[model samples]
Structure formats: structure tokens, C-alpha cells
Target chain A: MSMMKIGGWIKRILVLIFALVYLAPLYIAVVNAVKPYDEIIKSPLTLPKQFTLNNFVEAYQSSNMLELYKNSIVITVSSVALLILLTSMAAYIIARRKGKVYQMLYVFSLAGIMIPPVVTLIPSIKTLSALHLLYTMPGLLLFYAGTYFSTTIFLYVGFIKTIPASLDESAFIDGANPFTTFFRIIFPLIKPCTATAIIFLGMWIWNDFLNPMYILGFRGGKTITTGIYNAIGAYTSMWNLVFANVMLASLPIIILYLCMQKMFMQGLTSGAVKG
Target chain B: MKHNKLYDTLFLAPGFLVYIIFMIIPVIMCFLYSFTNWDGISASFRFIGLKNFVNLFQDASFFQALKVTLIIMVLTTLIYNILGIILAALLNDTGKLLGFSRSAIFIPTVLSAVVVAFIWSYVMQTNGGVINAIIEMFGGTKVDFYATPMTTIFMISGIICWNSLGFFVVIYISTLTTIPQEIYEACKVDGAGWFYRFFHITLPLLAPGITINCILSVAGGLKQYDHVKVITGGGPGGATQTVTLFGVEKAFEYNRRGYSSAAIIILFIIIVIFSIVQLAISKKHEVEY
Candidate 1:
């Protein structure tokens, strides 16, 4: 009994320490984001003596902060919209399916789960150029559809299979088309899947770098990531501006994450375990 | 049935077609082109057979990239799975502190790697870098973590793990929620020690989470480019280069599409092999409920 008590104490301390080490970077980022460059370098771990907004103000202006935010929002929202519609439909069919053809289609869609985005990075250029969709929002939307098709479909398929098919058949009996049945009846039932997609794809597309860098072609529109990256590149040694840029870049998504903790965790676990 | 067949064809065709053309075909094309001498701009290039592979074998940059990539895979996977499970167990309960930590850790996971990279680079900088500043506050030398590619890659690897560990922890935490409390209660009554309970009860039950986390970590680590690219740009003469970075540089920067394709194909094979091996090992340990 005594030994168990001793062991539990030690385990608790170790876990506490490990959690801090794991979280050190985020803690460091928050600390430095508010400090002056000189103070930041001198006392990184210390609390800020005086809060200043110059770095963020300058970082915002230089990084095209508003434009970047707008671009990121549009891209993430649009792609996720396309993804939910297309993927959930495919997943609906595949999940109701038990035959060989359906299973093959289901598995075919799931096969994209393994091909890393890098493998397609170059070839996407070729495909995109051929389609005349390169360097356009629609082109990148198609890319996300292709890139995340398997994973998102996997989530929808898992959730859909557990949903009763009789609900759909009855809806069909009530003069509903497959599209109507899916969009009106089935889609709402799959709120869990939508939650998963919104969280997963929103996070991914919002934070994506490589595809946007090449596909977006460095002009016209820039997502938050590539925009901030370019901003930092210009300010290479100016740590103050970079830290300011980082905070601005992550602000929206971090706020969303904090607010939707349960949905985010549920969404992640479903996607991870199902895949 | 007619409508059924049509819907199947209509819905399936567009999404699947786009996916296959953009994703699957490109990957296969990448595989085929890697064996040739195509400079991407040329109208045509010959099938040089295994020559690109041979050249890749001889390229010191390729070897350095492989080293860096493998180190990242091992380090991030280790850090993610180990620390993830621990965090899940610790904060699985409901509390102000636990809830706050859970929310806090998961916040970084949502931000883009570009953003995370830029942030960490600022924090890890030598002069005004937050990490060194903190070290100096305790009278320690302010070390330049990125002075060498070796040090830089490790720091990047650590940062990458930090960015991802949040997602994995939330997954583990959710999985933990699904575990029945009665099992733990029964084990405690059996005089099972914490280590014994963890090894015997918790670990086996966490198999599903383990398989998922391992596969995701390996794939994520294998394709690590964005953070590293933003952090080092595969710099110091490509010493911190990863396979993805090498392949991207080959295709976009150097316009060596064929060589880039070959590198991606190799990475594809590596990911497949690693997944298969992990699947087999983890499946063997799955204790049936």
C-alpha cells in the first residue's frame, strides 16, 4: 500500500514535468509575442514589463495581414464546403454498399489515405496546368478534394455505416431524390461527420503551405501561411516583427480551437481511429 | 435502381475522377518520371531506366536528406506517442486545470505549419530568441540552436512534434473517455500497481489509438516539409533537407522533374513498408475486449 502511494506520487510529478516540456514552445511563443525585442532576448521566460503594439502593428502592415486573413478564410471555407458535399455523398453511397463494386469504390477512395501530399506536389503542377486551374482558388479547391478525398471520405463512411439505412429508404418513399435525401435528411444526421470535416479540413486547408506556395503562384492572393512566410523572409533578422507576425497568423485558429475544444477532440479521435 | 446506378455514377465519378487524375495519376507519373532525365522544361526526355536511382544512390545530398528524414520520423513519432499517451492519461479527468491544458495544447495543432515554423524560429533565434533569452536569465550561454544543420534539424523536429502532439493527445483523450471506468476499478481491486495497470490494462486497450497515432505520425513525419522549409529552407547546403524537401527542391527549384519523381516514389515505398510493418506489429498486440 505504501509502495503504491509512493509510486503514484512519482508518476504524477513525472507526468507534470513531461507536460510542461511538451508545452514549452507554446508558452515561449506567448511570452515573446508581447515583449519588446530587446527584452525578449534578455528575458525570454519572464513576464512582459510593458505591453507594446508596434511589432504587431508593423507586422500587420508588412504581412498584408488583412488580405492574408481574408484569403485564408475564403480558401478554407470554400474547400471545406466542396469537400463536405462531395466526400459525404461518396461516403453515403459507399457506406450503404455491401457489394463488391461498392466495396471496391469505397476502398479505392480510402487508398488516398497513404499517398503523402509531397508525392503529388510536383505532378499536381502538371495536372493543374493541363486543367488550366493552376494558381487559382478553384484549382487549389480541386487539389484539396483530391488530397483529402480519402481521409474525409473515410470519416463519413465510418459514421454513415452506423446510421440506419431505413431512414434513407423511407425518405425516398416520401418522394425524395437521392440528393435530397442526402442533403436534407442524411446530411443533418451526419452532423458528427460535418463537425469532423469542419475541424479537420478547416485546420488543414487554413494551415497548408506547399500547395498554396506553388499553386497560388506568389501573386494576387496569398493565404495566411505563405503571406506570413514571405513577411518573415523580408524581416529575416527582425525577431520582433517575426514574433508579431506569428501571433497575428495564429490568432484566429487558436481562438476557434479554444472555443470548440470538445468538437475538436471528438472530430480528431473519429478521424484518427477510423482511418 | 436506375436512379441508384446513376447517382452512384454521377456522384462517384466527379470526385473520384478529380482525385485519381490529380492525386493517383500524378503519384504514378512521379514514379515513372523519376527514372528518366527530364528537366521538366524539355519537350521530351528519354527513359534513362535506373540511372536516376543510381544517381540518387550516389548523391550525398540524398543520403543527408534520408538521415535527416529518418531522424525526424523516429524523434517525432517517439515524442508524439509517448508524450501524447501520458498527457491523455493525466488530463483525462475533468477539472479547470486539465480542461485548460487540453484546450491549450490542442490550439497549436490547428495553426498551419508555416505559422508554427515562423513562430518557433522567432522563439528559437540566438540573439533575441525567446529560448536563449530564458537560458541567459539563468546565466547560461545563449546557444544558437540553428548554427549547425544537425542542431537546427533537431530543433525543427522538436517543434514539429510540439505542433502535432496536441492533435494526438486529443485523440488519445477521446479514446480514453471511451474506456470504461469499471475496468480500472476492477484492476485496482486486484492490487495492480500503476505500472502494471498501465502495461496490462491501459496499453492493451489503447491499441486502436496506438495504431492510428503510429501510422499518422510516421506519414506526417515522413512528409515533413512545410515547417522545415519555412524554418531552414533546407539550408546550410541542404544538410537539414528531408526527402520531401529534396524532392520539392529538385522539381521546383532545379526543374529536375524526373529526379524529383524518383525521390517521391522512394518515399512512397518507404511509407508503405513502414505502415505495413507497424500494422502487423500493433495488430499482434491487440487484446480483444
Candidate 2:
């Protein structure tokens, strides 16, 4: 019994130390962001002698934080909303119907899951330019729709399979058309699945760096990731400004994850494990 | 119930149209473009039959990029899975310390890769870097992370693992929960020590999660761009460039669209082959619950 108690105490202490080590980088970022440039250089590991919000102010102005927030929010929101609607509708039909065509369509949708986005990026630039959507927000949105359609539909189809067909039949008997039944009846019941989709897709689209960098380019507005990259690229040696920008870029997502910690983990694991 | 064909078509058309136009069509175009010498801006180009693939096979830089990519892939996959399992097992209990540690580890997973890369860049910088600061405080030499291409790539791989290992850990922990307590109890009753139980009971039961994470991490590592881009921008004459970065630079910067497409297609093929092999192997070993 005494041995067991000693082992438990050791385990707890070890875990606590690991937790602090895990948080060390974040501590470095947070502390350095508020310190003066000389202070950061002098003693990065210590508590700041004096703190200021000047770095945040400078980072906000220089990086065009407002424009980045606007672009990121618009792209993430539109892409996620469109993905949810289109994937769920398609998944609904594929889930309900049993036919060769439906099965083929399901397989076709799953094809995108394995192909990395970089594979299509070069060719899509050509397609986008032809459609006059290149270097535009909507172009990136359509590209995301194409890229993520597979995984999103895969999730919805699996979830929709578990939801009984009786609900659809009842709605159809109530004088509802297929479209109305799906949107009004089936969509609501799949809230958990939709929540999962939203969390996964939302985080992905928001944090996406490569696609936005190429598709949006310089003339097109910058999303947070690209904007911060460009902003910090110029201020590389300015640790204070860099951390400030990092904090600005990451705070919203970090806070969101903390607030919805359980949902975030569930969404990520469900999407990966099931898909 | 009878299905309305029109409604089904309507439901599928929009997504299919986007998917086909942007995803499928582009893939086909990529294959076609690999045989052409079309500069991205050119209105017309000549048919270059197998020229890009032939050149890619001979190109030293292309081979270098391939080597770097594979190295990063192997390193990250090994670290994320091996370290992840250990961390998951250690932190599996429901206690404040365990929960807090889990959350701390996962926080970086939520942050953007770009952000994580930037934070680590500062931490790893040679002059007055956080790590170097502590080292110098103890009268140790500063380690230059960018001393050589290989060193830079390995350091970047470590950073990538640090940023995303939390994700794999969470997956393992979830998988750990699904294992029955009785198995561990049974092992304990047999006088099996922690190492023995872990090897006999935990490892085998965790195979499915291992397969998923291995595939995910391998694919992710093979396509690494964000961290390397922010840290080095594939600089010092493309020393640490991955296949994706090399392909992008070639296509956009040098107007070698055909060659670039071939490079990316090669990566695609490699990923597909590995994924298939992993699936097949995992299927053979999967323990039915």
C-alpha cells in the first residue's frame, strides 16, 4: 500500500512537470510579446521588468489585423457553410438510396480524401483564371469546396446512416417535398454531425496557410495566416513584434478551442478515426 | 420509399460540379500538363513527351527534395506515434494534473502551423534564442539550428512533431479508453509489471489507432510546407525544400509547369502507395474486439 502511494505521488508530480514543459513555448510567446525589445534580448526567460501593449498596437496596425480578420472570417464562414449544406444534402441522398449510381457517387466523393490539395493547386490555378476567379476569395472558397467535399460528405454519410429512414418517411407523408424534408427535418436531427463538421472544417479553413497564400496571392486580400507571415517576415528580428503578431493571429482560435475543448477533440477524433 | 431522381440529381449536382471542375478536372489536367512544355503564362506550348519525368529523374535538386521529404516523414511519424503512445499512457488517468497536461499539449495543435513555426523560430534562434539563452546561462555553446541543410530539416521535423504530437496523443488516449479494464486487471493478476502489461495488453489493443495516426502523420509529414516555409522559405538555394515547396517554386517562379506537375504527381503516387500498404498491413493485424 505504501509503495502504491509513493508511485501515485511520483506520477502526479511528473505529470505536473510535463505540463509546465509543454506550456513553456506559450509562456515564451506571451511574456516576450509584452516586453521591450532590449528586455527580450537581455533575459527572455525571466519575468518582464515592465510590460506594455505597444507591441500589440504596432503588430495590429502593421499587419492590417482588421482586414485579415475580415478576409479570414469571410472565407472560413462561407467555405464551411457551403461545405456543410452541399455535403449534407449529397450525403442525405447517398445515405437513403440504395442503387448503383448512389454507390458510385459515394465512391467518387471519397476520391478527394486521399489527394492532397497541393496536387490540384497548380491545375486549379489554370481553371480559376479561365473562370476569372483566380486570386479571389470566391476562388479559394470553390477550391476548398472541391478539396474538402470528400471528407465532409464521408462524415455526414456515416452519421446520416445511423439516423433512421422513418423520419424522412414521416416528413414526406406530411406533404413535404424532398428538399423541404431534408432542410427542415433531417438537417436538424444531424446537429451533432454538423457540429462535428463545423468544428473540423472551421479550424481547417481558418488555419489554412498554403492554399490561401497561392490562390489569393498579393493583390487579393490576405487571410490571417498569410498576412501574419508577410508581416512577420519583415520583422523577423523583432521578437516582440513577432510574438505580438503571433498572439493576435492565434488568440481567437485558441480561445475558441478552450471554450469548446470537448467538442473540438470529439470533432477532430471523429473525423479522423471514422473517416 | 421511392426516390425522386430529379431531387437526388439536384442535391448532388452543385457539389459534384465544384468537385469535378476544381478537383477532378485539375488532376486530369495535371497529368496532361506533365507532357507539355507550357510556361504558365504561354498561350501555346509544345508537346514534350516524357521530358519532365525524364528530367526529374536526373535532377539532383529534385532527388534532394525527395530525400528531405522522406526523412522528415519518417522522423515525424516515428516521434508522433512513439512519443504519443507513451504520453497517452502516462496521462490516461483522470486527475487534474493529467487533464491540465493534456490540455497544455493540445493547445499548440489548435494554433496555426504558421504561428507555431514562428514561435519556435524565436525559441530556436542562435543569438539570444530562448533555448540558447538558457544554455548560455549555464555556460554552454549556442547551437545553430540552420548550421546545415540536414540539421535544419531535422530541427524543423522536431518542431513539427512538437506542434502536432498532441493531436496523435489525443487519438491514442481515446483509443486507450475503448480498451476494457479487465484486460489490464487480468495482466496485473498474472503478476505482469507495467512494462509487461503495456507491451502485452495496451500495445496490441492500440493497433487500430496506430494505423490511423501513422497514415495521417505520414501523409501530413510528406506534404510538409508551412513550418519549413516560415522557418527557412526553402532558402540557402532550396537546401531543405520538400517536394511540394520545390514543385510550387518551379511552377510559379521558374515557369516550369510541366516539371513541377511531374514532381507533385510523384508525391501523390508515393502517398497513395504508402497509404495502400499501410491499410493492407493494418487489416492483417487488426484485432477484432
For candidate 1, the per-residue lDDT at A261 reads 72
My TM-score estimates for the predictions, one after another, are 0.93, 0.98
Best by DockQ: 2
Compared with the true structure, all predictions reach lDDT values of 0.83, 0.91
Residue-wise lDDT of candidate 2 within B22-92, one digit each (tens)? 88999999888889998899889888899999999999999999999999999999999999999999989
Tens digits of lDDT, candidate 1, A1-275 = 79866755665566556657656776666767777888865666777887888888888888889998889899989999998888888888888867898888887888888998988878787778888888888988888889999888888888998899889889878888888888888889999778978888888888888889898877648988889888889868777687788888877777777777777777777766653
Question: Which regions of candidate 1 deviate over 4 angstroms?
Answer: A1-24, A34-36, A41-43, B1-3
Q: Which docking class does model 1 fall in?
A: medium
Which residue pairs show backbone clashes in model 2? Answer: none
Model 2 lDDT, full chain set: 0.91
Give per-residue lDDT, candidate 1, residue A169.
81
Chain B structural similarity (TM-score) per candidate:
0.96, 0.98
Interface RMSD after interface superposition, model 1: 2.6
